[model samples]
Structures are given as C-alpha cells and as structure tokens.
Target: MTPVPTAPLVRWYRTSLAGHPDGLNFRRLWVGDTFSQFGTQVGLIVLPLLAVSVLGADEFEMGLLATFETLAFLVIGLPAGAWVDRMRKREVLVVADLVRGLALLTLPAAWLLETLTFPLVLVVAAVVGVATVFFDVAYQSYLPSLVPSERISEGNAKLQVSQSVAQIAGPGLGGVLVRALGAPLVVLLDALSYFASVLFLLRIRHREGPIRRSGRRLHSEIGEGLAFVFREPLLRRIVATTALGNLAGSVTNSMLVLYAIRDLGIGETGLGLALSVGAVGGLAGALLAEPLLKRVGEGRTIALALLPALPMYVLVPLAEGHPGQAAVTMIATSMAITGVGVVVYNVAQVSFRQRLCPRPLLGRMNASVRFVVWGTMPVGAFLGGVIGSRFGVLTALWVGVAGQALAVLPVLLSPLVRMRDLPRGLDQHA
Candidate 1:
C-alpha cells in the first residue's frame, strides 16, 4: 500500500471542530476535558508539594502515596469494567467526576479548618484514585460510540493535545497557586473543574446506545474479557509491551519531582517551569503522531519512538547543578517521546481491540487488559522509592532507564514490530 500523505496534525484538530454534526456537544466535551485536565495538573503538582513541604514526607511516604492511589486498579479494574458495561457509560463518567470533585473539596475544607493531616491527604488521594479509574475505563469505552472508526485517531489526537496543553500550563499555574493560596486551597480549584466537566457532559445531546450486559456471573464475565485479551495475538503482544513500558515509566515518574528538588537542587517553581517547558514537546509529539504512524506503519513507528527514550532517560539523572537548562532539555525531550509514543500506540491498540472484540465484550476486554497492564504501576512506584532510598536517586534513574530500554525487547521479538498491517480480525495472526 502506498503510504498515506502526511499532513499537519493541527488540520486534524480543525476538522474535529468543524466536521461533526454534534459539533457543539463535542466542543463542550473537549472544553470540559481541558478544564478537568488543568485542575488535575494542579493536584498533581500541589499534592506532592504538600507531602514534601507541609508533612515533611520522605521518599517512602511519597512512594506510599503513589502506591495507594494506583492499588485500586489491581483490585477493582475487572469488576469496574463488568459494572460499567451494564450501565450508561456517560452516567458513570458524570458520577465519577462528581465523586472526585467532592473528594477533592474535602482537602480544602479540612485545610481551612486547620484539621488537614497526612492521613486526610492519603484518604482523599485514595478516593480520587478510585474515581479516576472508573472515569478512565468508561471514557475509553464511550469514545468509539461517539465518533466513527476512521476518525477515532483524530478525535483522540484532539484530546491528547488538550491534555498536553494542560500539562504545559497547569504545573506552572499550580506552582503559583500553591505559592499564593497554599496546597490545600489549590485542590479546590480542581474540584471546581470537575463540576464544570459534569455540566458540560450534561449538555451533550448525543444519546448513547443501551449498555450490553452478560447474564453470566461477574467473575465469569470478567474471565471472558481476560480470555479474549490473552487469546488474541495482537492484544497479547501489546499488553506485554505496555506492561513492561508502564513498569519503567512508573518508576521514573514516582521519583522525578523528588529527584528534582534534592538531587538537581531545584525549587518548586523552577521544577514546575521545567516540566511546563517539556510539555511543549509533548504537544508537538501528540500533534505529529498520526502522520508518523501513517508513514512508518504502527509497529515500526512505535519501535522508533521507544528508542528515543534511552538517551533521554540517561540525561535525567545527570541533570544536576544546572537545574534550569538541564531540566528544560530533559523534560522537553522526555515528554516529546512519551506524547508521540502514547498517541500512536493507543490509536493502533484501541482500534485493533475495537475492531476485533465483539461489541458486547468491549467493556470487559478493556477492564481485563487494564488490570494486567496497569496493575504493575503501584508495584513499580513502591520499588522505585525503595531503590532510590537505598541506591541514591541517580542510581535509581539508571535502573529506570535500563528497564524502559529493555521493555522494547518484547515488541522487537513479537510480530508487532515486523507486521506491515494491523490484523483484520482477532483470529488473524499478526
């Protein structure tokens, strides 16, 4: 097949805005997501600052927080999938947003009352974490029903761009908020963002189809999803590669802020600025991903994206003393690679799964795959802290680089890297 011509990804954004009949609803949803993303970015920055600045948390406490937040995915992902499959996904999404908003509100309230404690932070984090898992699962399943298959990549690209823009702006805004209003108060803004998201979702007039439910027991239904993922050749390879990559990514992510403060001798504001700059690369990468995928093929494109991180990961630890310049370079390069890789990988993986998995099984299949792939995150986060404390932050970074670099081996060995085209059906071997 002749390679599809590359076009500027911004064109996809323009088309997404103008092409759909429910253009207003789509715009509302996108705007809502952008606002929610902005708020979430605030929490991501402020929460850690709270631990380090107010609670005097060490590496272990930070790691524990990370672990607690993600642990629910291991326990609840499968069942959540089963439950969501039987309900209106939009309703689930709305409710999840509200729940998260309420949970975040507690932090600011407690702070105002002078009752905020480390335990309170932990509880709130866990609650938000649970809500996040539900929202993510439903959101992924809900998108296919909203847009056509050929447009899925484009639609997702728009969302990714929104997120990248938030990442670029949010942390800096968060840092200022934390500095001016305090960490706890910063969370209130996030809460309000979620509320805004709920309002936007309510305005969406596009009705979704009835939810698919299996009369089988929950456990049995969960098993069916798992069976589909493991039995499919393409899914199996993607899962393996993703699980390994996540393990590495989580390790690095868990320590990045802490490393920046202690090892790199950077303050919170400087760290935020660096991260914000890096998100620019992420924005560029997300914009370019579809064109890259079309030209190189999904498998080869993914493999090439994976290789860029090897050098970038190594540079992260070496970025000491020269905090501003080193951080800007490190974050920008890292985000660029991650943004592109995630967009391309998700487009191929999601489209493949949707095309092959029976519509009835879509929810469960997503949940099962998530349980296996995302379940490793908490483990990686915990291990990262333990390793960082014992071996030093720089050494821990090296380990992360090694693990992430080696993760590409699975894709390299699988038919995923060599296959010229995505399989037409679940049963077709790659």
Candidate 2:
C-alpha cells in the first residue's frame, strides 16, 4: 500500500457536544451527512416506486434500473478516486451533491410537464449513480481529516448511527410523503435534501490546500490503488468477503420485493412493514457496535457479525403464508439480522481502513475498494434477474442467500481472524 502523508489534527477527547465528547467539526459533518443520506433514502424508495407506478416499468425494466443505479461503481469507481485525491474533498462532495440534486429535480419537472419517459428515468438514475461514485469516495476519505486519530472509531460509530437512523426513518417518512403529495413530490424531498446537505457542508470551516499532484498518469494511479488493495492481505481479504457477499445480497435484494408481492402473497404494505422492521436491526447494531467491539475486538467483531446472518438467510427462501404474514415476519427477522451484521461490519472496517491507510491515499484506496466490492452489485442484480426469471424467484433467493452465507469463509481462514486490533502506521493522523 502507498503511504499517506500525515497531517496533524486536534485531539477532541475532552470536548462536549450536547453531553457528547465529539468536536463541533465532526458534528457538522455528521449532520450534513445525515441530511443528505436521509434524502438519499427517500430518493431510493421514491425513484423505483415511481418507476413501477408512474413509468409503468416491468420486472425487466426494474432490473435495468437497479443495474444502472450501481453500474457507476464499476464504471467510474477507480478514476473518481484519483480525481478526488487531486481535488478538495469538500468541493468534490459539494459538487456531487449539487449534481445529484439537479439530476433528481429533473424527474419531478418531467413528470409535472407530462414529458417523462422510461429512458429518461434510466438516464436520471445513471447520472445520479455516476455522481455518487465521486461523492461516496470523497465522503469516506473526509472523515479521518475531520477528527482525531484515536477518535476515528467513535466517529465511524456515530456516523453509522446516523445512517442506521436514516434507514429506520427514511422509508417510513418517504411513504407518508408519497401518500400525501404523490411520487413526484416525494422526489422533491430528496432533491431538497441534497440542498440541505450542501448548506451544512458549506458551513464547515475546514480548509484544504491545492491538491498534491503526483503527476502520475491516471491509469497508473488507478492501477496503484488497485494494486495496493490486492497486495495487502487484510484489504485483500476485506474486498473478497465484501465483493462476494454484496453480490449475493444484490441478488436477494433484486428479487425480494417482486417475490414478496408476486409469489409469497404479500402486499405492498406488508412488504414495506417488513423492510421497516428490518431496519431496526441496523439501528441496534450501530448502537451496540462500541460495546461489541470493546468486548470482542475488531477482527472477531467483523467475523461474528456476518456469521449469524448466514443461517438467518434461509428464512427468506422458505417463507410461506397467505399474504405471507408469518413469512413477512420471518423475512423481516432475517433482514433485521442481516442489517445488524452488515452495519457492525461496515463501521468496524471503515475505521480500520481509515487507520490502516495513509491520508493521501484514502480517497484512492476507498474508491478502489468500492470499485471491487460495490462493482459486483450491478452484475449480481443482473444475474439475480436472470436467475429469477429463468429458474424461479425462490431458486434465485437460494443462490443469492447461499452466496452471502459462504462469503464469510475467506475471513475466517485469513489473517483477519486472529487480529485483536487493526494495525496503525505512522502515516495516520494522531
């Protein structure tokens, strides 16, 4: 891995914010992040619902929409990291937010004007997808710069709480807004969320110098990030586990709503409730993560979180009932478990990555990681669609769930299993 150039940061262990120990800068970042993410969650639901309800998209079209939504991770994931490293993280984040907001705003306008087309929806999805590639990479990279090194764990844990809260709240809020104002109006909420995020980001007073240009060729820089990840044993392990697991997850996700509504006899309301119930587990995981990590250590925490979800995944495929009320309970339980496992693992590993990698390479490293890990999602969604259509949705569920279950094996056998704490280097900010 390439070494990061260490920058000095303030120690924030003694501060109090509403009785919390984190600093004001982190609070600003978190608030902005939460607002944007809440909007994102709203957008995520409203867009697809609109696709089906307003655009009259079929299963195939929904699959394509899912693919386009994440395909940017594979397409621009690497280079975006490189560009992010050459630019101010805040600027990159702000521009990405603006782009996403503007792209989404077009949807409501087109719908109001009665000029919305299915292809136009796909274009909007794709554009947002591309901008997200940059936003996400910069977002992850920005954290270590905003807080003390020792506090990165707390920062990550806190951020996960916001995300988990969003997961729990965003969908329900979105549903209500959709019901009150309709789908297009619900999209306006997301567009406005981006603006809200921008407002918070603009309020952040942290400054950055001109991007340190390595003057290396873009492809070479991209390759360097990839090589760094592939070369390091821990990162390599993380990527493999996440990539395969997410691939399977994408399959389950792609088919979940369709199967619930079409095959399992569950209605949209039941499906929505099941998903909402499932998000509670994420909130729990985020809240419990610190204590869990304190007791179990990082490696085992990562491993244990995902391990339980393996067996829990079976309930989804075996779900049965008229309206699948019982099945819905079973499925929601499974999602709850999956959410806990995923959130804990995510929070722990993000802190680990921030600690392990040099600051200068954080953007590229995260981007590279996302490239390999998240890139598989689009493929998995496409595969899920193919498998569900060909073999039946239940069969597709098994394949996806089974893949997710098996992905944990790589970590159990690797160096990650034995580590008590993540290794930190001199390049880290302290």
Error of 2 at 430 (Å): 3.7
Pairs in clash, predicted candidate 1: none
**The best candidate in terms of lDDT:** 2
lDDT of 1 by residue, 1-430 (tens): 9967657565654566534555666666677777778877777888888877777777777777777777778879899888888978788889988998999899888878989888888888888888888887887777766766566566677777888898889888877777787777778888998998898888777787765655679999888889989998767877887888778877877787788766666667777787787677667766886787688776666555566555666667667555576665766566656555665666666666766776667788888888888998888888888887788666767778788877877667777677656755443231
Task: Rate residue 233 of model 2 by lDDT.
Answer: 82
lDDT per residue as tens, model 2, 46-98: 77777766776655666677788899999999999898999999988899999
List per-prediction Cα lDDT, in the order shown.
0.76, 0.82
Error of 1 at 40 (Å): 2.3
TM-score for all models, in order of appearance: 0.91, 0.92
Checking candidate 2 for backbone clashes, the offending pairs are: 4-358
